[model samples]
Target: MTANSPLANPADPADRGHLLTEQANPRSAQLDRLSALELVDLFNQEDQLTLAAIAGARQGLAAAIDTATEALRQGGRLFYVGAGTSGRLGVLDAAECPPTFCTPPDLVQGIIAGGAGALVKSSEGLEDVAEDGAAAIADRNVQAHDVVVGITAGGTTPYVQGAIAAANRRGATTVFMACVPADQVPTEAAIDIRLLVGPELLAGSTRLKAGTATKMALNILSTGTMVQLGKVYGNRMVDVAVTNTKLRDRALRILCDLTDLDRQAASDLLDRSNQQVKLALIMHLGHLNAEAARDRLAQHQGKLRQALEARVSG
Candidate 1:
């Protein structure tokens, strides 16, 4: 090849050679040449890898759940930090915690590089600013009790790396989620989760398989933590906020299913407990008034099952 040609001999940095997410998939070498149906079929095949990737990371994911649950039980917060599509996914997961689990808004937060404005636009450049990630951690006053999860699809986003380091210095537990091998771009987090779904169908576009895997991982992390913290009871969102018609119906259904009460009776019980499903269930099963059931729940740190057991055993 000519010296000026694109194929001319060059030194490839270690970072450039090891990233699996950026590699071209042999299966999709002719991605652009495929028919519409072929492309759809290929995409579906690639997506299946995402689930397997999560399954592989089960141990690390469980560790993350434990760390986050312990931190939250100690009155600490949970933070999801990432950039671009990764950042948006973190933000979406954190946003859902409030209504679904009745958590305070500040209990779980998402920090995206380039701020909230970057959610809609391409803020790719900001991911390289490692210092900003550290600053974002400081901005939130992350402490020893908090758990911060840093997500990077290719696993080398400097911003995520920076956030993880700062979280370490602050004594907060750090969990790292990436879509590449640990040897490629290690984050040295307390809990390191690798979602290895191989190369993207469209080359370096991680928004496909990598994005889905990351979203599923975050969902498991947050939801599992909430479950440990007693936000759920018997597969029901006992702490769900009845903010709308659908949620009201769900709360009523949970009551009826658990207590075998008719619709009117369940609705009345929900009102008596101030529309709190957990309190309503507690009051019914423990054979106590709403105030007494609430006291028991508080004594048991919001764990409904334990409170009911204590009431039964006492």
Candidate 2:
């Protein structure tokens, strides 16, 4: 390639070929020769490593959960930053939070290198721009109470690294998630989560095992944080937004299972509570009207169990 080519960076000295996520898997050496069923079996075997990787990073994940929960409790926001598949996964998780936990849209956000367009089409070339990542953080007005999570499978994405560095300067709690080890790619994040899923089955394709592991980690992080925030009651999504028929049915079922109400009565109560399962439960269990139940919930910080317990003890 010519030195003047836009893709050529002759002065850049970073070499990512040695990263664990970039290595070729010996078991997949004969990938092209495998039968369809064999390929499926081999993939199943390799996927087991994703579970082990999650287990290995359990402590770090828990720490991130705690940090994020505390930040949200204090009115802080959670932001996930990345590029490519990692970025799309972050955006997906952030988008699901509102419907599942009745959170505000801005409470959890996703920042990709090329913005929303990258979620569908490939804008991988944008991942190389460190300044763009830093600018994303600045534009968001990230503050000290915010939590910023930087996800990069190879742990060398300049965009993610730049965002983390910018977050640190803004005094936000930073969490870094990667498939590589610290020895290979270190970070200044408050919490470092290494999935360590090793090489991909397709040789350097991190969208495979690494992507799965990241989704699992994000599931735990977001769910655990919401639980700590009192969005759940007895393992049920109490704060679930009844935005559709399916969610309304789930809310009704939760009421029937948790309270003495049957299907019809639960449906009536759900309507009375403005389709809020938690509020309906509080109204029934605490013997309060809709307004009083809302007051109790506000007093108890939206914790259904705490609101009921305080009423009983009173």
Candidate 3:
């Protein structure tokens, strides 16, 4: 209803600057008339900003990871809510957690404004509905222990704002990620992460730089948080779920790398442990049986490195 309110002009495309994927070229005069090689160089130069934006948000990201981890430790969930590219990125991150860290699907969840159908198709209309966003959180039964992250390029999506508001009301920790400056970031969310990669290559097209920044941040959040939670061991995805041929191959490689075991031995360990890479690693490294390996893992709180070290020391 007010000028600063997210619901005021939900339909206005310009007001959703953070959601806009296209950014105008500052060197429009030179870039618009450049040759192929020149254009390539220009685009490459523009992409350099994405990493810098991520670097600047390191502190905020670290805080978010800590908050999310604390919430998960207490039997809570992590929820990602957004629209369009932001929503898709959130879903992408959530989908990867199970295979990468062997986490439960419900541990990290993503909610798009327009639902599953909107993942592939653009459902711009849903972005304007405050109630739709609020309902998504309510239906999930978000509680005080949960951590909800709202993603929006422009920092002004009604759906994202509404979701953060609802999550906060329910006593859940709320984090907001956007491309705008901190001063321009919406005040509804508790933690504001502004990955300001500047404007897009095409005017108002946020999927360019903004999307890239969001993807990078999400990668750090999920991977870093998992590592902190002991899902990883010394740069290895120890808890990786071998659900496919590629993953099975990767698991074999991980065993070989960690224990210097022959292919046959690693394969035997993998089979003996039912394709659990961490358990296989522990069994071989710790020279323990499946049950003993599992018990050691539990003793170390699933930290393979610490468990292996204790075994070696003992």
Best by lDDT: 2
Q: After superposition, how far is residue 114 of candidate 3 from its true place, in Å?
A: 0.7
Q: After best superposition, candidate 2 residue 275: deviation in angstroms?
A: 1.3
Local distance difference test, candidate 2: 0.92
Query: 2-102 in candidate 1: lDDT tens per residue?
Result: 23422122224454655799889999999889999999999998899999999999999999999899999999999999999999999999999999999
Each candidate's TM vs. the true structure? 0.93, 0.95, 0.93
Mark the 10 consecutive residues where model 2 has the least summed lDDT: 2-11
Clashes of each: 0, 0, 14
Model 2, span 1-314: residue lDDT tens: 23343222211435677889989999999999999999999999999999999999999999999999999999999999999999999999999999999999999999998998998899988998766888999999999999999999988787887788889899999999999999887778999999999899997799999999999999999999999999999999999999999999999999999988899999999999999999999999888899999999999889888988888899
**35-59, model 3: which lDDT tens digit per residue?**
8998788778888999999999999
Off by over 4 Å in 1: 1-17
Ranking by TM-score: 2, 1, 3
Model 3, position 42, has a per-residue lDDT of 74
Q: Looking at model 2, how many pairs of residues clash?
A: 0
